[model samples]
Target: MQFSIAFPLAALTLLISTITAQAPGSQCGGIGWPGIMFCNPGSVCSKINDCEGLHGSLADQM
Candidate 1:
């Protein structure tokens, strides 16, 4: 059915978009870092030693 094909295609598109859009382990909040920061779903930005960054497993990793 058209629904079946559409569902999988939509899911694939979403996954690819998520991967390309988010920078899971990249730097987030810290001194001398002037930029907006964000983490992927199911995680939060936290301090990692001297610089703040995202510290959580990504969806693809799980």
Candidate 2:
């Protein structure tokens, strides 16, 4: 019984990690003109260089 629980838990952890391992650009964040912008959750615009108020212009435009 313990082995069965451990197996499923391990499998679920692996699956979750795998799904989240994809590029951050794959999810919604911001726009970077030439490329997709990505930021951590709850991150401020100031944290990203090409994000609106951060750099004035998109990275691709610069």
- Highest TM-score: which candidate? 1
Query: Per-residue lDDT tens digits of candidate 1, residues 13-62?
Result: 76775664436566667777675454555655667766665545545345
lDDT scores for all predictions?
0.64, 0.44
User: Against the true structure, whose lDDT is highest?
Assistant: 1
Candidate 2, poorest ten consecutive residues by summed lDDT: 52-61
RMSD of each: 7.0, 10.2
For model 2, name the residue pairs that clash.
none
- Model 1 RMSD, rounded to 1 decimal: 7.0
Task: List, residue by residue over 9-39, the lDDT tens digit for candidate 2.
Answer: 9988766754544243243333554433433
Per-model TM values vs. the true structure = 0.40, 0.35
> Which portions of model 2 show Cα errors greater than 4 Å?
22-62
